[model samples]
Target: MSDANNQTKAAPKHSAMHIAVGLLARRDYSRQQIQLKLQQKQYDADEIETTLDHCQQSGYLDDARFAALLLKSHISKGHGVNKIRQSMQQKGLSRALIEQVLLDSECDWFEVAKLKAQKKYGEAVPLDHPTRAKCIRYLMGQGFDYEQANYALAVEVD
Candidate 1:
Protein backbone atom coordinates (compact mmCIF):
# COMPACT_ATOMS: atom_id res chain seq x y z
CA MET A 1 0.00 0.00 0.00
CA SER A 2 1.12 3.54 -0.69
CA ASP A 3 2.35 5.55 2.31
CA ALA A 4 -0.27 8.24 1.54
CA ASN A 5 -3.07 5.70 1.65
CA ASN A 6 -1.74 4.30 4.90
CA GLN A 7 -1.33 7.75 6.39
CA THR A 8 -4.83 8.92 5.46
CA LYS A 9 -6.65 10.40 8.44
CA ALA A 10 -10.19 9.88 7.19
CA ALA A 11 -12.29 7.60 9.35
CA PRO A 12 -14.88 5.11 8.09
CA LYS A 13 -18.10 6.59 6.81
CA HIS A 14 -20.43 3.63 6.97
CA SER A 15 -24.06 4.64 6.76
CA ALA A 16 -25.27 4.58 10.34
CA MET A 17 -28.57 2.90 9.47
CA HIS A 18 -26.89 0.40 7.20
CA ILE A 19 -24.35 -0.51 9.84
CA ALA A 20 -27.13 -0.98 12.40
CA VAL A 21 -29.09 -3.26 10.10
CA GLY A 22 -26.02 -5.22 9.09
CA LEU A 23 -24.99 -5.73 12.68
CA LEU A 24 -28.51 -6.75 13.77
CA ALA A 25 -29.00 -9.02 10.77
CA ARG A 26 -25.87 -10.87 11.73
CA ARG A 27 -26.50 -11.31 15.48
CA ASP A 28 -27.90 -9.66 18.58
CA TYR A 29 -25.82 -7.32 20.72
CA SER A 30 -26.44 -5.23 23.81
CA ARG A 31 -27.32 -1.63 23.01
CA GLN A 32 -24.18 -0.46 24.73
CA GLN A 33 -22.11 -2.88 22.73
CA ILE A 34 -23.61 -1.51 19.57
CA GLN A 35 -22.98 2.06 20.63
CA LEU A 36 -19.41 1.22 21.48
CA LYS A 37 -18.92 -0.48 18.16
CA LEU A 38 -20.25 2.56 16.35
CA GLN A 39 -17.88 4.80 18.24
CA GLN A 40 -15.03 2.49 17.52
CA LYS A 41 -15.86 2.64 13.84
CA GLN A 42 -15.52 6.44 14.02
CA TYR A 43 -19.10 7.21 13.10
CA ASP A 44 -20.12 10.83 13.66
CA ALA A 45 -21.37 10.93 17.23
CA ASP A 46 -24.61 12.71 16.42
CA GLU A 47 -25.32 10.39 13.53
CA ILE A 48 -24.64 7.36 15.67
CA GLU A 49 -26.97 8.60 18.36
CA THR A 50 -29.71 9.43 15.86
CA THR A 51 -29.37 6.09 14.13
CA LEU A 52 -29.60 4.21 17.39
CA ASP A 53 -32.62 6.25 18.41
CA HIS A 54 -34.36 5.52 15.13
CA CYS A 55 -33.49 1.86 15.22
CA GLN A 56 -34.74 1.49 18.76
CA GLN A 57 -38.03 3.21 17.91
CA SER A 58 -38.43 0.89 14.93
CA GLY A 59 -38.05 -2.15 17.22
CA TYR A 60 -34.74 -3.17 15.71
CA LEU A 61 -32.86 -2.76 18.98
CA ASP A 62 -34.66 -4.44 21.85
CA ASP A 63 -32.76 -5.27 25.03
CA ALA A 64 -35.45 -7.60 26.38
CA ARG A 65 -35.50 -9.63 23.21
CA PHE A 66 -31.73 -9.78 23.17
CA ALA A 67 -31.65 -10.95 26.79
CA ALA A 68 -34.26 -13.63 26.18
CA LEU A 69 -32.38 -14.89 23.16
CA LEU A 70 -29.12 -15.06 25.07
CA LEU A 71 -30.80 -16.87 27.95
CA LYS A 72 -32.34 -19.44 25.67
CA SER A 73 -29.07 -20.05 23.82
CA HIS A 74 -27.10 -20.54 27.03
CA ILE A 75 -29.73 -22.87 28.56
CA SER A 76 -29.90 -25.00 25.45
CA LYS A 77 -26.16 -25.36 25.65
CA GLY A 78 -26.70 -27.04 29.08
CA HIS A 79 -25.78 -24.08 31.25
CA GLY A 80 -27.06 -23.72 34.81
CA VAL A 81 -29.33 -20.94 36.04
CA ASN A 82 -26.53 -19.09 37.78
CA LYS A 83 -24.36 -19.33 34.71
CA ILE A 84 -27.15 -18.09 32.49
CA ARG A 85 -27.92 -15.14 34.80
CA GLN A 86 -24.28 -14.12 34.98
CA SER A 87 -23.89 -14.33 31.22
CA MET A 88 -26.95 -12.20 30.67
CA GLN A 89 -25.75 -9.67 33.21
CA GLN A 90 -22.35 -9.52 31.55
CA LYS A 91 -24.14 -8.84 28.30
CA GLY A 92 -25.91 -5.91 30.05
CA LEU A 93 -29.34 -7.33 30.85
CA SER A 94 -31.08 -5.77 33.81
CA ARG A 95 -30.96 -7.96 36.94
CA ALA A 96 -34.71 -7.70 37.55
CA LEU A 97 -35.57 -8.74 34.01
CA ILE A 98 -33.04 -11.53 34.04
CA GLU A 99 -34.57 -13.00 37.21
CA GLN A 100 -38.09 -12.56 35.90
CA VAL A 101 -37.41 -14.26 32.60
CA LEU A 102 -35.48 -17.05 34.25
CA LEU A 103 -38.39 -17.63 36.64
CA ASP A 104 -40.97 -17.40 33.86
CA SER A 105 -39.11 -19.94 31.75
CA GLU A 106 -39.76 -22.48 34.51
CA CYS A 107 -36.34 -23.88 33.75
CA ASP A 108 -35.10 -26.33 36.37
CA TRP A 109 -31.93 -24.37 37.02
CA PHE A 110 -30.26 -26.93 39.24
CA GLU A 111 -31.28 -29.76 36.99
CA VAL A 112 -29.72 -28.09 34.00
CA ALA A 113 -26.40 -27.93 35.80
CA LYS A 114 -26.72 -31.50 36.97
CA LEU A 115 -27.43 -32.75 33.51
CA LYS A 116 -24.50 -30.82 32.07
CA ALA A 117 -22.15 -32.18 34.71
CA GLN A 118 -23.33 -35.73 34.19
CA LYS A 119 -22.87 -35.43 30.47
CA LYS A 120 -19.35 -34.08 30.74
CA TYR A 121 -17.96 -36.26 33.55
CA GLY A 122 -20.16 -39.35 33.03
CA GLU A 123 -22.37 -41.44 35.32
CA ALA A 124 -19.20 -42.68 37.06
CA VAL A 125 -19.23 -39.26 38.78
CA PRO A 126 -16.38 -37.18 40.21
CA LEU A 127 -16.81 -36.98 43.99
CA ASP A 128 -13.25 -36.63 45.16
CA HIS A 129 -12.10 -33.19 46.28
CA PRO A 130 -9.76 -32.51 43.35
CA THR A 131 -12.20 -33.79 40.76
CA ARG A 132 -15.14 -32.00 42.33
CA ALA A 133 -13.15 -28.80 42.50
CA LYS A 134 -12.37 -29.06 38.80
CA CYS A 135 -16.02 -29.65 38.01
CA ILE A 136 -17.08 -26.69 40.17
CA ARG A 137 -14.59 -24.40 38.46
CA TYR A 138 -15.78 -25.48 35.03
CA LEU A 139 -19.36 -24.68 35.98
CA MET A 140 -18.40 -21.31 37.42
CA GLY A 141 -16.44 -20.38 34.30
CA GLN A 142 -19.60 -21.22 32.44
CA GLY A 143 -21.22 -18.63 34.79
CA PHE A 144 -22.51 -20.72 37.69
CA ASP A 145 -21.82 -19.88 41.33
CA TYR A 146 -20.14 -22.08 43.92
CA GLU A 147 -23.51 -23.12 45.35
CA GLN A 148 -25.08 -24.03 42.03
CA ALA A 149 -21.90 -25.70 40.90
CA ASN A 150 -21.67 -27.77 44.05
CA TYR A 151 -25.35 -28.62 43.95
CA ALA A 152 -25.16 -29.77 40.38
CA LEU A 153 -21.99 -31.76 40.95
CA ALA A 154 -23.49 -33.38 44.00
CA VAL A 155 -26.50 -34.56 42.08
CA GLU A 156 -24.24 -36.68 39.92
CA VAL A 157 -21.26 -37.12 42.24
CA ASP A 158 -23.23 -38.05 45.32
Candidate 2:
Protein backbone atom coordinates (compact mmCIF):
# COMPACT_ATOMS: atom_id res chain seq x y z
CA MET A 1 0.00 0.00 0.00
CA SER A 2 2.77 2.39 0.89
CA ASP A 3 4.61 1.54 -2.34
CA ALA A 4 1.47 2.19 -4.33
CA ASN A 5 0.91 5.49 -2.49
CA ASN A 6 4.46 6.62 -3.16
CA GLN A 7 4.21 5.74 -6.82
CA THR A 8 0.97 7.64 -7.13
CA LYS A 9 2.40 10.76 -5.53
CA ALA A 10 4.25 11.57 -8.76
CA ALA A 11 8.01 11.70 -9.31
CA PRO A 12 9.98 14.26 -7.35
CA LYS A 13 9.87 17.53 -9.17
CA HIS A 14 13.25 18.57 -10.53
CA SER A 15 14.53 22.09 -10.15
CA ALA A 16 14.04 24.24 -13.25
CA MET A 17 17.77 24.75 -13.55
CA HIS A 18 18.43 21.02 -13.54
CA ILE A 19 15.78 20.44 -16.15
CA ALA A 20 17.09 23.29 -18.30
CA VAL A 21 20.64 22.01 -18.01
CA GLY A 22 19.62 18.52 -18.98
CA LEU A 23 17.84 19.85 -22.04
CA LEU A 24 20.83 22.00 -22.99
CA ALA A 25 23.22 19.11 -22.65
CA ARG A 26 21.37 17.31 -25.39
CA ARG A 27 21.33 20.16 -27.91
CA ASP A 28 21.27 23.93 -28.23
CA TYR A 29 17.90 25.56 -27.70
CA SER A 30 16.77 29.11 -28.24
CA ARG A 31 15.53 30.95 -25.16
CA GLN A 32 11.98 30.69 -26.44
CA GLN A 33 12.40 26.97 -27.12
CA ILE A 34 13.71 26.43 -23.61
CA GLN A 35 10.88 28.42 -22.12
CA LEU A 36 8.33 26.44 -24.10
CA LYS A 37 9.91 23.16 -23.08
CA LEU A 38 9.94 24.16 -19.43
CA GLN A 39 6.33 25.11 -19.67
CA GLN A 40 5.50 21.76 -21.20
CA LYS A 41 7.30 20.07 -18.32
CA GLN A 42 4.98 21.86 -15.92
CA TYR A 43 7.56 24.03 -14.21
CA ASP A 44 6.23 27.03 -12.34
CA ALA A 45 5.99 30.05 -14.60
CA ASP A 46 8.00 32.26 -12.28
CA GLU A 47 10.59 29.57 -11.71
CA ILE A 48 10.95 28.93 -15.42
CA GLU A 49 11.48 32.62 -16.08
CA THR A 50 14.05 32.93 -13.27
CA THR A 51 15.90 29.82 -14.38
CA LEU A 52 16.04 31.04 -17.96
CA ASP A 53 17.44 34.37 -16.76
CA HIS A 54 20.08 32.58 -14.74
CA CYS A 55 21.00 30.36 -17.67
CA GLN A 56 21.42 33.39 -19.90
CA GLN A 57 23.45 35.26 -17.32
CA SER A 58 25.66 32.23 -16.78
CA GLY A 59 26.26 31.92 -20.57
CA TYR A 60 24.60 28.56 -20.68
CA LEU A 61 21.74 29.75 -22.85
CA ASP A 62 22.91 31.83 -25.80
CA ASP A 63 20.43 32.53 -28.58
CA ALA A 64 23.18 33.90 -30.79
CA ARG A 65 25.19 30.73 -30.59
CA PHE A 66 22.10 28.67 -31.18
CA ALA A 67 21.14 30.76 -34.20
CA ALA A 68 24.63 30.58 -35.66
CA LEU A 69 24.75 26.82 -35.32
CA LEU A 70 21.35 26.38 -36.86
CA LEU A 71 22.23 28.68 -39.74
CA LYS A 72 25.43 26.83 -40.48
CA SER A 73 23.69 23.47 -40.35
CA HIS A 74 20.96 24.65 -42.70
CA ILE A 75 23.48 26.14 -45.13
CA SER A 76 25.47 22.95 -45.15
CA LYS A 77 22.29 21.09 -46.02
CA GLY A 78 21.91 23.39 -49.08
CA HIS A 79 19.24 25.65 -47.65
CA GLY A 80 18.81 29.12 -49.17
CA VAL A 81 18.65 32.40 -47.26
CA ASN A 82 14.86 32.78 -47.33
CA LYS A 83 14.34 29.21 -46.14
CA ILE A 84 16.87 29.61 -43.39
CA ARG A 85 15.24 32.88 -42.37
CA GLN A 86 11.82 31.24 -42.25
CA SER A 87 13.14 28.33 -40.23
CA MET A 88 14.78 30.65 -37.72
CA GLN A 89 11.57 32.58 -37.39
CA GLN A 90 9.69 29.35 -36.72
CA LYS A 91 12.17 28.63 -33.94
CA GLY A 92 11.07 31.89 -32.31
CA LEU A 93 14.14 33.92 -33.22
CA SER A 94 13.69 37.64 -33.60
CA ARG A 95 13.76 39.16 -37.07
CA ALA A 96 16.68 41.30 -36.04
CA LEU A 97 18.66 38.28 -34.92
CA ILE A 98 17.86 36.42 -38.13
CA GLU A 99 18.79 39.42 -40.21
CA GLN A 100 21.98 39.97 -38.25
CA VAL A 101 23.03 36.36 -38.69
CA LEU A 102 22.36 36.49 -42.42
CA LEU A 103 24.19 39.80 -42.76
CA ASP A 104 27.19 38.30 -41.02
CA SER A 105 27.19 35.16 -43.14
CA GLU A 106 29.82 35.08 -45.93
CA CYS A 107 28.23 32.20 -47.89
CA ASP A 108 27.22 32.83 -51.45
CA TRP A 109 23.65 31.62 -51.99
CA PHE A 110 24.13 31.69 -55.78
CA GLU A 111 27.05 29.32 -55.70
CA VAL A 112 25.34 27.07 -53.24
CA ALA A 113 22.25 26.95 -55.45
CA LYS A 114 24.36 26.11 -58.48
CA LEU A 115 26.18 23.30 -56.74
CA LYS A 116 22.98 21.87 -55.29
CA ALA A 117 21.22 21.99 -58.63
CA GLN A 118 24.14 20.36 -60.38
CA LYS A 119 24.30 17.62 -57.81
CA LYS A 120 20.61 16.86 -58.06
CA TYR A 121 19.84 17.45 -61.76
CA GLY A 122 23.21 17.14 -63.47
CA GLU A 123 25.31 20.09 -64.70
CA ALA A 124 23.12 21.18 -67.56
CA VAL A 125 20.09 23.45 -68.05
CA PRO A 126 16.82 21.57 -68.46
CA LEU A 127 16.19 20.87 -72.16
CA ASP A 128 12.44 21.29 -71.99
CA HIS A 129 9.93 23.65 -70.34
CA PRO A 130 8.49 20.88 -68.15
CA THR A 131 11.93 19.78 -67.01
CA ARG A 132 13.02 23.38 -66.48
CA ALA A 133 9.94 24.11 -64.40
CA LYS A 134 10.56 20.98 -62.36
CA CYS A 135 14.12 22.00 -61.71
CA ILE A 136 13.03 25.48 -60.74
CA ARG A 137 10.45 24.09 -58.32
CA TYR A 138 13.03 21.84 -56.73
CA LEU A 139 15.44 24.73 -56.14
CA MET A 140 12.66 26.92 -54.81
CA GLY A 141 11.69 24.18 -52.41
CA GLN A 142 15.29 24.16 -51.23
CA GLY A 143 14.94 27.86 -50.30
CA PHE A 144 16.73 29.35 -53.30
CA ASP A 145 15.30 32.54 -54.73
CA TYR A 146 14.03 32.68 -58.30
CA GLU A 147 17.14 34.37 -59.64
CA GLN A 148 19.51 32.00 -57.88
CA ALA A 149 17.62 28.93 -59.08
CA ASN A 150 17.45 30.22 -62.62
CA TYR A 151 21.11 31.16 -62.53
CA ALA A 152 22.00 27.66 -61.36
CA LEU A 153 20.06 26.08 -64.22
CA ALA A 154 21.96 28.34 -66.62
CA VAL A 155 25.37 27.02 -65.56
CA GLU A 156 27.02 24.81 -68.24
CA VAL A 157 27.58 21.13 -67.57
CA ASP A 158 31.28 20.21 -67.37
Candidate 3:
Protein backbone atom coordinates (compact mmCIF):
# COMPACT_ATOMS: atom_id res chain seq x y z
CA MET A 1 0.00 0.00 0.00
CA SER A 2 2.77 2.45 0.88
CA ASP A 3 4.66 1.51 -2.30
CA ALA A 4 1.63 2.19 -4.45
CA ASN A 5 1.07 5.55 -2.74
CA ASN A 6 4.71 6.49 -3.29
CA GLN A 7 4.45 5.67 -6.97
CA THR A 8 1.36 7.80 -7.32
CA LYS A 9 3.09 10.71 -5.56
CA ALA A 10 6.04 10.45 -7.96
CA ALA A 11 3.80 10.69 -10.99
CA PRO A 12 3.16 14.10 -12.60
CA LYS A 13 0.39 16.04 -10.97
CA HIS A 14 -0.55 18.05 -14.07
CA SER A 15 -0.97 17.27 -17.73
CA ALA A 16 1.86 18.34 -20.04
CA MET A 17 -0.52 20.20 -22.28
CA HIS A 18 -1.93 22.14 -19.34
CA ILE A 19 1.49 23.30 -18.26
CA ALA A 20 2.41 24.32 -21.80
CA VAL A 21 -0.81 26.23 -22.22
CA GLY A 22 -0.48 27.96 -18.86
CA LEU A 23 3.04 29.07 -19.68
CA LEU A 24 2.22 30.35 -23.15
CA ALA A 25 -0.78 32.22 -21.88
CA ARG A 26 1.53 34.30 -19.72
CA ARG A 27 4.02 35.61 -22.36
CA ASP A 28 6.28 34.53 -25.15
CA TYR A 29 9.02 32.24 -23.92
CA SER A 30 12.05 30.95 -25.75
CA ARG A 31 12.21 27.19 -26.11
CA GLN A 32 15.00 27.13 -23.60
CA GLN A 33 13.04 29.12 -21.01
CA ILE A 34 10.04 26.88 -21.52
CA GLN A 35 12.14 23.78 -21.20
CA LEU A 36 13.91 25.00 -18.09
CA LYS A 37 10.68 25.94 -16.41
CA LEU A 38 9.10 22.65 -17.36
CA GLN A 39 12.06 20.73 -16.01
CA GLN A 40 11.88 22.68 -12.78
CA LYS A 41 8.32 21.53 -12.39
CA GLN A 42 9.53 17.93 -12.67
CA TYR A 43 7.58 17.19 -15.81
CA ASP A 44 8.54 13.95 -17.60
CA ALA A 45 11.14 14.66 -20.27
CA ASP A 46 9.49 12.59 -22.95
CA GLU A 47 6.09 13.96 -22.14
CA ILE A 48 7.46 17.49 -22.17
CA GLU A 49 9.15 16.89 -25.50
CA THR A 50 5.95 15.58 -26.97
CA THR A 51 4.05 18.56 -25.64
CA LEU A 52 6.64 20.97 -27.03
CA ASP A 53 6.39 19.35 -30.45
CA HIS A 54 2.67 19.61 -30.43
CA CYS A 55 2.84 23.21 -29.25
CA GLN A 56 5.21 24.04 -32.11
CA GLN A 57 3.01 22.34 -34.67
CA SER A 58 -0.03 24.23 -33.38
CA GLY A 59 1.89 27.55 -33.30
CA TYR A 60 1.63 27.86 -29.51
CA LEU A 61 5.40 28.19 -29.38
CA ASP A 62 7.80 29.60 -31.93
CA ASP A 63 11.43 30.62 -31.48
CA ALA A 64 11.57 32.56 -34.72
CA ARG A 65 8.58 34.63 -33.76
CA PHE A 66 9.96 35.06 -30.27
CA ALA A 67 13.17 36.41 -31.81
CA ALA A 68 11.26 38.99 -33.81
CA LEU A 69 9.40 40.19 -30.73
CA LEU A 70 12.66 40.48 -28.86
CA LEU A 71 14.22 42.44 -31.68
CA LYS A 72 11.35 44.87 -31.98
CA SER A 73 11.14 45.58 -28.27
CA HIS A 74 14.89 45.98 -27.96
CA ILE A 75 15.07 48.29 -30.95
CA SER A 76 12.29 50.44 -29.61
CA LYS A 77 14.12 50.76 -26.29
CA GLY A 78 17.45 51.49 -28.09
CA HIS A 79 19.30 48.22 -27.59
CA GLY A 80 22.39 47.57 -29.76
CA VAL A 81 23.09 44.55 -31.91
CA ASN A 82 25.43 42.83 -29.45
CA LYS A 83 23.14 43.37 -26.47
CA ILE A 84 20.15 42.05 -28.35
CA ARG A 85 22.11 39.09 -29.62
CA GLN A 86 23.31 38.20 -26.16
CA SER A 87 19.82 38.57 -24.74
CA MET A 88 18.39 36.23 -27.33
CA GLN A 89 21.25 33.78 -26.98
CA GLN A 90 20.61 33.53 -23.24
CA LYS A 91 17.11 32.47 -24.21
CA GLY A 92 18.58 29.81 -26.60
CA LEU A 93 18.32 31.58 -29.94
CA SER A 94 20.96 30.60 -32.49
CA ARG A 95 23.59 33.08 -33.64
CA ALA A 96 22.56 32.68 -37.26
CA LEU A 97 18.98 33.63 -36.47
CA ILE A 98 20.16 36.67 -34.51
CA GLU A 99 22.40 37.80 -37.36
CA GLN A 100 19.62 37.39 -39.89
CA VAL A 101 17.25 39.50 -37.81
CA LEU A 102 19.74 42.32 -37.36
CA LEU A 103 20.68 42.26 -41.02
CA ASP A 104 17.07 42.47 -42.07
CA SER A 105 16.10 45.24 -39.66
CA GLU A 106 15.66 48.67 -41.28
CA CYS A 107 16.32 50.60 -38.07
CA ASP A 108 19.33 52.96 -38.27
CA TRP A 109 21.60 51.47 -35.62
CA PHE A 110 23.93 54.47 -35.66
CA GLU A 111 21.11 56.89 -35.14
CA VAL A 112 19.93 54.74 -32.30
CA ALA A 113 23.26 55.03 -30.54
CA LYS A 114 23.33 58.81 -31.00
CA LEU A 115 19.85 59.29 -29.69
CA LYS A 116 20.60 57.17 -26.70
CA ALA A 117 23.80 59.10 -25.95
CA GLN A 118 22.15 62.47 -26.41
CA LYS A 119 19.46 61.61 -23.92
CA LYS A 120 21.99 60.47 -21.35
CA TYR A 121 24.12 63.61 -21.77
CA GLY A 122 21.16 65.99 -21.47
CA GLU A 123 22.53 69.39 -22.64
CA ALA A 124 26.28 69.47 -21.76
CA VAL A 125 27.44 67.57 -24.82
CA PRO A 126 29.65 69.27 -27.48
CA LEU A 127 31.31 71.51 -24.87
CA ASP A 128 32.42 68.57 -22.75
CA HIS A 129 35.00 66.37 -24.42
CA PRO A 130 35.23 64.09 -21.39
CA THR A 131 31.49 63.69 -21.26
CA ARG A 132 31.44 62.99 -24.97
CA ALA A 133 34.10 60.34 -24.57
CA LYS A 134 32.12 58.87 -21.70
CA CYS A 135 29.07 58.79 -23.90
CA ILE A 136 31.14 57.06 -26.57
CA ARG A 137 32.22 54.48 -24.05
CA TYR A 138 28.69 53.93 -22.81
CA LEU A 139 27.44 53.45 -26.35
CA MET A 140 30.26 51.06 -27.09
CA GLY A 141 29.33 49.14 -23.97
CA GLN A 142 25.89 48.78 -25.53
CA GLY A 143 27.59 46.88 -28.43
CA PHE A 144 27.65 49.57 -31.12
CA ASP A 145 30.53 49.24 -33.56
CA TYR A 146 33.29 51.83 -33.23
CA GLU A 147 32.30 53.49 -36.49
CA GLN A 148 28.67 53.57 -35.44
CA ALA A 149 29.58 55.00 -32.07
CA ASN A 150 31.81 57.64 -33.63
CA TYR A 151 29.12 58.79 -36.02
CA ALA A 152 26.52 58.85 -33.28
CA LEU A 153 28.77 60.88 -30.99
CA ALA A 154 30.03 63.24 -33.68
CA VAL A 155 26.62 64.41 -34.81
CA GLU A 156 24.58 66.38 -32.32
CA VAL A 157 20.92 65.57 -32.46
CA ASP A 158 19.09 68.87 -32.87
Most accurate candidate by TM-score: 2
lDDT of each: 0.81, 0.92, 0.83
RMSD of each: 4.0, 2.0, 3.1
Tens digits of per-residue lDDT for model 3 on 24-127?
98899877788888889888899889889988898999988899999999988777888888899999988888888888888899888877766876544554
Write down the TM-score of every candidate. 0.77, 0.92, 0.85
The C-alpha stretches of model 1 lying farther than 4 A from their native spots are 1-12, 155-158
Question: Candidate 2, overall lDDT?
Answer: 0.92
Clashing pairs in 2: none
> Which model, 1 or 2, shows the larger TM-score?
2
Off by over 4 Å in 2: 2-4, 7-9
Candidate 1 local Cα displacement, residue 77, angstroms: 1.8
| Winner of 1 and 3 under TM-score | 3
Tens-place lDDT per residue, model 1, 20-82, is: 879988888878778888888889889889988888898889888888898889888987677
**Span of ten consecutive residues with least summed lDDT in model 2:** 118-127
Ranking, lDDT, top scorer first: 2, 3, 1
Kindly report which residue stretches of model 3 are placed more than 4 angstroms away from their true locations once superposed: 1-12, 127-129, 156-158
